[model samples]
Target chain A: MNRDFAIECERLSRIYRSGSIPGRGRETPALTDLTMQVPKAVVFGLLGPNGAGKTTTIRILSTLLAPTSGSARVLGYDVVKQAKQVRERIGFILGGDRGLYGRLTGKQNVRYFGALNRLNPKTAKRRGDELLERVGLAAAADTLVEEYSRGMKQRLHIARGLLTDPEVIFMDEPTIGLDPMGAQELRQYIPELVGQGKTILLTTHYMLEADMLCDEIALIDHGRLVALGTPDEIKRNFSRLTIFEIVVNQTSETLTAELSNIDGVQHVETSAEGIFQKITIAVEAGVDARDQIQATIGAERVESLVVRDPTLEEAYVSILT
Target chain B: MAAALHNIALQAYYSYKGLFLWLNWTAYISNVFIAPVVFVVIVTLTGRFAGQSDSANAYIIGMAAYAIPAILSGGILQSFCYERTFGTLSLIYASRSNRWVTYWSKGLLHYPNGLLAAATSLLFGWLLLDLDFSRLNWPALVVLLLVISFSCLCLCLFVGNFSIALREWIIPVGITNGLLLITSGVVVPVDQLPGFLGEIGRVVPLTHGLSALREAFEGASLGDLVDDIVYELVVGLCYLLAGGFLFSLLEANAKRTGTYESAI
Candidate 1:
């Protein structure tokens, strides 16, 4: 384990056995032996589809559930043996827009959790004010939390997470229920926290959010890490071929066969819209198929062409499966 | 220690504040006033209808006098029960506050309010029911109420052990409240029961409590029932100590087994 690593795990796993009935016994494994590390002072995104064990990992790290086997640590403290210390070092905001006291004012709710973190009354009060201001909730400080919109509540939840000034924070789907504007506000705050040297562990399904905010990502599937690296790195490494779409004359079949026969042409497909056909051809970057394609199909047959780098979604779809 | 106490108290207050916003304060506020008044009124109504040997005023005073203990018992137990059932028990057990500090703060919260309600009930009964306290035994009365309250407070400490281990509080709440009412002789005098049932009542904390209450206002001195009063006090103390030890044992087991959160 790196000494500077903010989090480390060695074959961490969890198996939630079903409670035994009078005559039957059964069990299910929620997490496999997954090993990964999150370095200090950076945003590490845990990306996965729903039911892919992303939340389970967060739950174990947060000390909300005991791991069935192996070991894990957050901020150098053993999750089980030093839960109190770990709790002090890491604040968690769970997904699904829960974790708020809807009846209390936002300021009061923050103070309550601050108290739970053992902050002094005066200090808790001060932290509450500072956090409210930090999250742009100062104006709605005294208003009941129930009255706040979903976006506002999410902002308050983020503010609550910062109340303890933890060294590392976990945000699970922080923008799950927010509109574009609310997501924009939360997205804007991530960089500021990163600038302050706070190590953030964020989990989100939105690839754009991950690509925009996270310095690194570990893509999880079926309780396994399928890919792990920087966003750009994953996209570059997974993108085997560049795709080009050509709108040509309806008789583009002859051109398709010739393009397929080219040295680096990997695959070709076409869609017909009435009499016109839009042909898509993928070729390896090192070889040029344009000459062969135009030579066989003719200049008139090739009306227009578009070539672009692969998107993160395309890369993810190609790698995960 | 003070830091922990302040934190726990603030957290409890915030929970109550949250409850208030949801119109859930009925349960808490009733502990201070409504429950105690009900006890006093029940005793008074029973006394009038039955024309019992004791004056209606005396019955009211006796019942009202036990209000402090009743309130303490009701407050601690009710608070524990409600918090546990509502999924907020985590607020107490996992709190940054020390166990003893949290225990005492919760125990003391009901005393002042309970005593006030008791005093008010007694004043009302004395003025309207024409009961005489001129011959009342003040020292005996004070000791009786204190002992009774202490017993219930001790019971609270024990009930808390179960609450911590098993968060489904309905069973504990129903059992505790029902046991207190039946055994305390609050509804019917213990002497009226026959044989073993009556014998069981004699050993109950409420029997001793009610006996002391009646004796005090009837001008009976501590010297008159010295042995019984002493016995009740000793039994109450034993329950307190024994319950505390058992609670500590259960709490240790709960933490180790990681069963506290799964109890509900």
Candidate 2:
């Protein structure tokens, strides 16, 4: 009910019942008592692994799926009761290449979607051209989508999602299959759209993508919200343990056991990479076990040593574990 | 109202582009234009070989009526199936525009195409088979064509709804097409059909529409063929209402079941 929020949900839940015979199948909960709010004109990221209910949440908010219980509102309109209003103000780009007509050209696909949003033919065509150019696909606008590469198709998906000039856009892993350069270029457009005062709800498994693009991040697991804050705030709050990483020419079980016995060292993990061994030690705050670890492992065998703050991925792992 | 119309126009434009503009003209000609003409030719040749002029005439009219479902129903059903497979159905559902407008607009592509197919069949019959039109009641024929088109459109809508509602649409669509071909009195008179099939034939709009068309071709006035025309109109309306109701129920079920996201 907050007018200042672009999206608001209260106890939104979706329970999918399987099997054709009612009451004869198992019930799967895709979302559970989820409550969150996203303020207007900010980039919000829902960071989670696969099957973590991120896509389900996006589908519910986009008005494509109705919640089994509770409610969600987009721009002050109920996603279920006033789906038309919500849909009018929002656009969605789902992951993968399935949504497009492979037979149609990129420009034609954009124009078709624009028309579906009720743009006149001329306006749809003009806007479609503009969007194609904006997405760096103007040169290949006339080519069939089937002929385009995965990266080009992903870019076209972005252009189609923007055809309506929506006030809010839901991008569900838009860069899932893109190359490194392709993903970087696509990421650049997110802030540009936000600069124009549009709210974006992005879902991604890439922690770095979320850290780079999202102004606010909410991490969910098993259909439940686990952590919510800005990137730095999350790293600061959830990351209480210090970490020391050491690369050695060879590591034996004796060396790992010795490091484990060191006072204040909570956990030690090691993995073999080629001829070298990488070891990571998690220790309690205020503990300086670096010198002891170096002495136990023998400084001559140490290939490299570094101590650093926990990254977002490490923070996420810590929270989840 | 303006927005709805715009949506319709744009959807139709895109459907035509996808269906025709993207494909080779030769493919289009072979698929849409030539197939109907070939069917007419085969039927005429068979009828001529049997020395049954009256049967040949009936065959021509029946085949023309058959083209209605063949093109319109098939087109609409294929569009629905492809939308699911192509993953555009969810996108369309997510759009703010009215879903009914989008559905109907995609279907509009079939009308012109069906008309063209039917007309070509009739023209071929006239040129090659020397079919007599001297007794044709022009006004009645026009009315019959309109009624047939409306009835086919209703059937297409019904099939479209059924496709979305059913988890597996292929078997159901195949069965429905098979039933239409078998019981719609396309190849033979409903009266000549054995047992309960004749009774079921009486219920399909194609049966009524084809009956009225044959009557009009035989010089009957619209008033003279009142029963068939009335039956066609009633059947078409029934289909339209039933399809709309079923679509709502199935759509709600899909949301609850979470089947809407999958291509299935």
Candidate 3:
């Protein structure tokens, strides 16, 4: 309930139960003793794989689901007792086409959500028109939404989410079905919303997107927080592991086995690059076995080699796995 | 107060428009317009064949009145349950809308459509059955029909909310429509059933309204039909209150169980 925090949860947990019989029914724990705080204005990414409690957490913060235990607050309001207050200060966009009405025109869909958010007629119209233009949908605004492309539908969803001009926004898989260009445009849009001092909590499965967009990230797996930090900081956690990228005209099992036998080497992956084969070697930080690897492979066969730090994605995989 | 009413009105209009699969053009026309005529003609002719020609007018009036529930049962259910199908119902639950306003609006515009269906049914009755409307009190019949169709809407929402909360979506509407058809003096008089069923019919909407319609058609004055009119209105009011209670109750259960987010 801290005023400084736009979104806060203390030991928030949720367990979903099925079937009519209470004790006899099966229980699935979706979130377990999770705790985090999001500051007033930043894109806070909830990074996770699938079935990793990301949606459950987002739904709880959005006031769409009640926690089985613990507590969550949005803008200093308790989610259960002050749900209306939370709802008033927040707008959320779901990932796919499910939440929108297919028969309504894009403007009509926007107006409907605007009204749901209790916007007056003038404000709803003005803002709806503005957002449609912002999302590059003004030309198609009058068309029925079902006739729009998937990317267009996603843009309409974004317009609806911003209709309320909320203080905190929650988006689940916001770029789920967008094309590369569409996703890139949305990536630019996220920062502008944050620049307006609105806190955004977005769940994402894309490691690169999280690295590029998030001000702070909390990585979760199996309903627990596995890691939390800036992209650089998280990647620095695995800085002690160095990656060696090698290219050669050819590669064989003998070379791979020889590379594996190196004292501090961890993994060797090989893939084709046109007529050449690219070999990647991950080894411990201090073990700079450049000579041993070069001598083992014969210097004439080794075309080139480069050493670099593990990327955010590689660090994420190493930490989680 | 004004804003709340606006929300209700917008919700009513948009929900009805949004929930339509449009029913396909021909299917909707036949169901709402053509089928009522066939129902009235067949039932009225059957009464004549049974040597009960005296019941022909009664059958025509009952079948016409039935057009409201027939349309509303599907109409109300579609609008009420549509959010779940599209996975958008949770959007309202998650928003800053008043519970009463949101749920009440789901049943709002539907009854107006019910009134139109009943009119079509009666128009067919007037044309095909040669049912006489010369002495019928037109104003009194319109008013009674409005109240009766509204009451049927209240009853439909009541059953839809309570049963959907229990995860029974389709069955309750089916059962309620059949029960009303049998017990509301449609096709057969309620008094012909068991004593308890007759008492049941006395309170359900449309039973008393249809009775008043009969008296009005027989040249009875509006003042003389006050007893049936009052009883019909009272039944409607009761269902209206009950439907609100059940909707609030359904919302509470859904929130507690954390099942309010999606229809699936």
- Best model per TM-score: 3
DockQ of each: 0.28, 0.55, 0.57
- For residues A1-321, what per-residue lDDT tens digits would candidate 3 score against the true structure? 589999888899988898898679988898998999988999999987888899889888877778988999999999888988999999887788788888888998888777676777678889999999998999999898889888898898889888999999988888989899989999999999999999999887888898899998888888988877777777766445778888998677789999999988888888998888998888877887888888777788878889877877777777777
What tens digits encode model 1's per-residue C-alpha lDDT throughout A212-247? 999988888777777888888777766566777878
* i-RMS for every candidate: 4.7, 2.7, 2.2
Cα deviation at B208, candidate 3, in Å, is 1.8
Shift of residue B19 alpha carbon in model 2, Å: 6.3
Task: State the C-alpha lDDT per candidate.
Answer: 0.70, 0.80, 0.82
How is the predicted docking of candidate 2 categorized under the CAPRI scheme? Answer: medium
- Stretches > 4 Å off in candidate 1: A20-23, A236-310, A315-320, B1-5, B19-39, B47-113, B120-132, B137-171, B188-211, B219-264
lDDT of 1: 0.70
Residue A292 accuracy (lDDT) in model 3: 86
In order of appearance, the predictions have TM-scores of 0.76, 0.89, 0.93
Docking class of 1: acceptable
Tens-digit per-residue lDDT, B1-264, candidate 1:
786677877766765455322134586557656676677777787777887745676568656755655555545655554454444443334334444444444455444554565666666666656667788898986776666666666666567567556654446756765666665666656667666767776655656766777777778898886766777777667766676676546545444333444311
lDDT per residue for candidate 2 within A1-321, as digits (tens), equals 888999998998988777778678888998898999999999999987777889889989988788999899999999999988898899887678789888888988997888778877677888889989987899999999999998888889888998888999999889977889879988998899999999999998888888899989888888888888888877777656678989999777688889999999878989986789999998776888889999999999999998876778777777777
- The per-residue C-alpha lDDT of model 1 at residue B243 equals 66
Clashes of each: 1, 0, 0
